[model samples]
Target: MKRLAPHSPATLACTMLLALASQTTPAAARDADKPRPVVDFTSCAKPAWPKADLAARHSGTVTLSFNIDSQGKADAGTVVKSSGHAGLDEAARSGIAKCRFKNGPGAVQMQYVWVTE
Candidate 1:
């Protein structure tokens, strides 16, 4: 079977959403009012679908929350919500950690939804 491409619309959309969020307003301004630091996802690492899951056509969503350092790197990610499949949850967690965001506070959220075609 042909392996699924690493970059999917879901990943691209999520990354784009992050980028747009970062570009919308100044982090300093956001920090003044919002308790959570606004993060701008400037970079992305696409999540890989497990071979077994892909073969089985499994699908789910993972909600990830993590801290972004002042340097705009993801750190200390937690699975806010599981994707049901361990592989998907792990992939999303790893992927979220690889994401790059604008320098701000530590709190940030990212949701990864996987849908089989």
Candidate 2:
């Protein structure tokens, strides 16, 4: 009868092979567990004074901070920064509300910019 020793080469080779196999298996894939935000801009309606502003005059960017729940729904967020115009800010928020993310667990910060043409 022969007894196998723990430090034998056969034992080491078997252990290494098991570790390699586990690493290559797709079942071990890890899902992203971080927070992220999805952002988008809504098409601006014709400006009241398009003739004077030419779209560029009222063009500006707004920054919004929001939390995405595990289900990937955009929770009502705060307007961290504004484009100095109430209309533009509202537009940005409206666009953000329409955006959706994948079904997962995470959160993110995003910015939406609106420009006049």
The top-ranked prediction according to lDDT is: 1
Q: Pick the TM-score winner.
A: 1
Error of 2 at 38 (Å): 5.2
Q: Model 1: which residue pairs collide?
A: none
Provide the lowest-lDDT 10-residue window in model 2. Answer: 14-23
- Candidate 1's TM-score: 0.66
Off by over 4 Å in 1: 1-42
List model 2 lDDT by residue over 33-83, tens digit each. 332333222322322322232223465566665555666666765676786
TM-score of each: 0.66, 0.49
Instruction: Report the error of model 2 at residue 116, Å.
Output: 2.7
